[model samples]
Structure formats: C-alpha cells, structure tokens
Target: MSPLLRSPLAGSGPDLCYPLLLNTSCRLSLGPRFSASLLYILTFSLALLTVLLNLLLIVSISHFRQLHTPTNMVLLSLAGSDLLIGLVVMPLGAQYYISSCWFLGPWLCSAFYMLSYVLTSASVASILLISLDRYLAVCQPLRYASEVTMGRVQLAVGLCWSCAVVYNGGLLGVNMRGPPRRTSCQGECVVVVDGSSDWLDFLVTFLAPISTVVALYLQVFAAALSQARKMRSSWAAAAVGAAAAARRSELKAARRLGVVVVVFLLCYFPSLGFMGEDVSVNSAASFWSTFLLHLNSCLNPLLYALFYPWFRWTIRLIVTLQILKPNSSRATVLH
Candidate 1:
C-alpha cells in the first residue's frame, strides 16, 4: 500500500476510462463525468498533432541542406525531445487519465513517467542552449563560428540529455519509487507528492531553468545594447547604418527567444503555483493541473509553425504540390 492510496485524496487522479466524477473531498459522485472524456480528446489530439508536425519538421530539415547548421542541430534535438514526449509519454498519460488508474504494469509505468520527465527537462535545457547560440551569433559574430562549432554544439546537446536524465531521474526515484501508492481501484499506481517535494520540484525543474534562460538573454540584450551604442558613436561613418540595422535584427532575434522563454514559463508556472498551494495540491486541481504541463508537449510544433518562416513555407509548398497532383484521371485525359 502506497502513501497516496492511504491519503484522504486517494480518488484525486482523474478517472480517464471510468466515466464517473467523484469529488475527492465530498465523495459526491457526479453522474457520468465529462471531464475525463474531454481530457482524453485533448490528450489524443495534441499528441497526434505534435507527431505529424515533428515528422514534417524532421523531413523538411533533412531535405534542405542549407538548414543544416549547429544551431539547427540544437533545434533538431529539441524536436526529437518533443516527439518523444508526444509519442511515448502522451499515450500512457492519456490512458491513465482516461482510465483513472494505470493499467500498464509497474515497469512500464515507471518507464513512461521517467521518459516524460527526461524529455521535458531536455527540452527546457535545449531552449536555453538555443538562446545562448543566438546570443553568441549576435553579440560575438566574429568569434561565433569558431566558438559554437558543430563539435561544441553536439557536446552541449549531450550535456543537456545527461543532465535531464540525472535530475529528473532523481525526482522519479522520489515520486514513482520512493513511496508506495495505489490508485482508486486499489492497484499500484504512480506515487503522488501531495505536499512534500513540491517546492523543491518547482525550483529545480522550472525556476532554475527559467532563471538560467533569463540570465543568458540578459547577457544577450546587454551585448546588443553595447553594439547599438557603438553604432550610434560611428553614425557618420559609411558602414554605421549597416551595423545598426544588423544590431536591430539581432535584437529582434533575441526578442523571439524571449517569447520562447515567456511561453515556457506561462505554460508551466500555473501548475507549479497550483501545486504550491496546500489546498489545491490535494484536490481535483492537482489532477487537472497536469493539462497545462501536457500542453507543453504541443507548443514546440506550434512555435515552429508560427516563427520559423522557412519551415512554414516548406510545409506550404509540400501541401500545395500534393493538392495539385493529378490522380489516375490525368492519364485518361492525356490518352
């Protein structure tokens, strides 16, 4: 018997397949729950859409040689991490969310949980790396090529995955295996940290990453400001206008990265805050709070679709050609 199973909030996990709404506090059974049904639909749709978008991104990135660079290699790693969460973790989560209990065996349950944690952590780290890359390119253009070489980028990616595995794995040890727990049906389910480790989890997982990202961007912004000041001093010079324009573009790129940082915090922080509150931590809010976290899996694809112009254009080109392609009727018409 696990700690969660013995807790007062034992029925807190959203029952995905059972289709019954029982208030964790009141035990008032609401007839035929729709929340689980909605969650199921949302989880399935988001995961499927992400898979398609990531696959298209992979193919497009592969086919276009010009898109192959150290920076893109980091992007590719981020896409890969998103794809892992969408494909591997989302299905299990959807099943658990819908069923209300983890039907998957203990090994698989642990594996899925671990996989989601690792991939998500890696995704955050990768975003941090991307910010650093953009910073170097804009702030230190002359040395950027030599500094952010392919070998160094690959090492950074390797470090990202390694850190993700170790850090999140530690949490998995605490959450999944640390305490024994059972589901509403009295079977082995995931261990829920009702109150303990909540702040620690928030700091290590979300706050630390966010702080690092912000710090990197701050350095980038400062560097850009310095360049702008230099350009202003040389305003009468022939190349000053070009230099200013280039600096402005770099600032714009930094702003784009700032958007990424903002989105990540927005999508993740609510859940952290919800978990932070004692009352909410053990309520339906805890179960429903994960929806925001799950939304993180779907964000990368949307971000790329919206921000990466080349990727968008490539997708459009492929769609247009596919739509315009003639079927068997074209052969008959020619004859």
Candidate 2:
C-alpha cells in the first residue's frame, strides 16, 4: 500500500499532525481509520446540505417581490446567518473535528471563534424577533399592520445583526486580544471563557431569549385560541367570513413558525449543558451537541417546505430557473 494511503492509526510514531514541525505539532488522538472517515463524511455532508438549503431560502425570499413582506424580511435575515454558518463556521468545525488540531494559527483561530460567536448570537436574536413578530400578529391583529411595518422589521433585523456583533465582540474581547488565551499547547484551538462570562452568555443569549420566546408564544397561542372560538361563533356574514379566513391564515403561520422556534431551541439547548462543563472540543459529547445545534440550520427550511405552501411554490419556481426571467421577482408566490 502507498504510504499516503496508509491508515493514520497504523504504524504510528506518536501520529504527529504536522510531521515536519515535530516540536510544535499536535499528536493525533483519533480512533479507527474507518470511523474517522465516516465522521468526516457525515459532518461535511451536513455542512453542504446546510449551505444549499439556506441558500435556496435566501434566493427565494430575496428574488420574489410577493415574498417581500415584513415577516419574510425577518426570515431573509435568518437565512443569511444560517448560510454564513454553513459557509464559514461548519467547514472550520469539520476541519477541526477531522484533524483534532488547530493548524490555522492563533489569529485565524481567534477570528474563527469570533465569527462563530457573532453568527450564533445573530441566529438566537433572529428567533427572538420572529417570536415577537408572531406574538404581535396573533395577539394584536388590528395594530400588527401599523406596528410591524416592512421598514420597521428591516430596522429590527439590522439591529439584531448589529447587536450580535457588538455584544459577542465585547463578551469575547479578552480572548480576541493579543495571543490566543485558550490554548495550552501547540496545535490546540479551544475557546475557554471564564466561568462568569460563560454564565453571563448563558443568561443573555440562552436563558433570556428562551424565556421571552416561551412567554410570548404562550400568549400568542392563547389569543389565537380565543380568537378562533370567537370566529366559529360569529354570524355567517361575508365580511365576517373574510376576516375569519385571514385570522385562520395568521394562526397557521404562527403555528408553523412556532415549530421552527421550538426545534431551534431543542437543537441549541444541549450545547448549554455542555458549556457548563469543561469538555474538550474533540470529545463525543461536544461533537454531538455542536452537531445537533448546527443541524438546526438544515432542519429549518425542511420545516418550511413541509408546512408552508408558499415556500414549496417558491422552491419549485427557484429550482426550475423560472425565476431567471424578467419581472419574475414580481410574480405572485403566495395564494
């Protein structure tokens, strides 16, 4: 067998990641060759899937003018972040997982972690904003149009991304300054925030947003239920029926978005548990938790495809290249 094709674990002389840099290289600690290869394939495939699916969402929402509603504007922002996670963050993560070392050097490592933090915070903030949007639409139906205008939603989306950058930048400033503070040995790229900072991150990014989502969704569902009951008992008038249909449509939208939010939380929650502990990046617990969180990006568009008719129609249009024609952006996607 060729030397290059030989198993990484076979005939190992400590299995240095960079054989040339004996003093500075990291030692490989992976398992069997087949298992490692399988893991690499799985992670890379997931990363690719995340990128493609979220890209479809971005194109569908951005190209179609009929989809340029206040709520879809928020979704567009979310797709942007998810696409970045797939494009930038997941590939780096897969590299780390396969090599079990950080050969990218300290500066790039810091930049990578900073970008990851910002994107994650942005995603969480987007979910929060979505919850708020649904709450207002379902609970304050009369005022929703005036309050959650497209311009206002656009501003809110901008604020979400901006705050994520500023907040996580401040939170992770210490690690970003000078040399990387987390690594103890060469070829190691770990992010170790202090206990206080971890707790603070947990509170601000996870706890607070989760609390708000739960509370708001509860109110939204309650209001929707009451409104539904009212509609069912109302007179059989034409105006009333039209209003009831609109309300039903809004209720369905809220339910679909609620599933997305819940799945996002479920995928993200495990990472919080792992964060409280001192697990290494290469550990099984860490890999699974991180993988689950990243998998949420892939799951989101699938949910939209399942529950959202507009999304299905848009996907069909996008897939067939029908959207390439002139004035296609103005095409009606929603029934």
The TM-score between candidate 1 and the true structure equals: 0.76
Residue-wise lDDT of candidate 2 within 1-335, one digit each (tens)?
A: 00001112222337777778788776765667687788778878988999988899999898988888998988888888888888987878767765666678878877788888888888888899999999888888889977889899999999988888888888878535676675555766766676677778888888899899999999989988787677665464345877778777888889999999999989987777655445553366666777788888888888888988888898899889999999999998888
Error of model 2, residue 313, in angstroms: 1.8
- Per-model clash counts, in order, read 8, 0
Best by TM-score: 2
Q: Quote model 2's TM-score.
A: 0.92
For all predicted structures, in order, the TM-scores are 0.76, 0.92
- The segments of candidate 1 whose C-alpha lies over 4 angstroms from its true place after superposition are 1-35, 174-188, 193-201, 224-237, 241-246, 274-283, 317-335
For model 1, give the RMSD to the true fold: 7.5
Shift in Å, residue 102, candidate 1:
1.7
For model 2, what is the C-alpha lDDT against the true structure? 0.78
